[model samples]
Target: MNTPQSMMLGWGSLVVAAGVSFYYAKKTINERRAVQESMGQRPSEKLDCASFLLFLHCL
Candidate 1:
C-alpha cells in the first residue's frame, strides 16, 4: 500500500516538472522571437524549435 502511494507521488511530481519545463521553454522562445523581431532581425523559427528540443534532452 505504501509503495504504490509513494510511486504514484513520484510520478506525479515528475509529470508536473515536465509540464512546467515545457511551459517555460515556450515562454522563453516567444520572448526571444519578439525581441529579435523588434530589433529588425528575421527570427528563425527552426532555431527556436531546435532549442526547445535540446532543452528537453538536457533535462
Candidate 2:
C-alpha cells in the first residue's frame, strides 16, 4: 500500500542515521585511543570490563 516516494523517504532517513552513527562512533573511538596512548596503556582493552560482565549477568 506504500508509494515509491514514501519508501524513498524511509530509506533516506535510515541512511542518514547510519551515517551519523558511524561518524560519532569513529570520533569517539579515536578520542579513546588518544587518551589511552597518552596514559601509556593499550587502547584495545575494555575500560569497564567489570561493568560489562555485570551487565551481561543481569541480562
lDDT (C-alpha, whole model) for all candidates? 0.89, 0.91
Candidate 1 lDDT trough over 10 residues, lowest sum:
42-51
Q: Mind giving the per-residue lDDT tens digits that candidate 1 earns over 1-57?
A: 569989999999999999999999999998988899889896555567889899899
RMSD of each: 8.7, 5.5
In model 1, which residue pairs have backbone atoms overlapping below 3 Å?
A: none
lDDT of 2 by residue, 1-59 (tens): 88999999999999999999999999999999899888989656665988888989999
Off by over 4 Å in 1: 43-59
RMSD of 1: 8.7
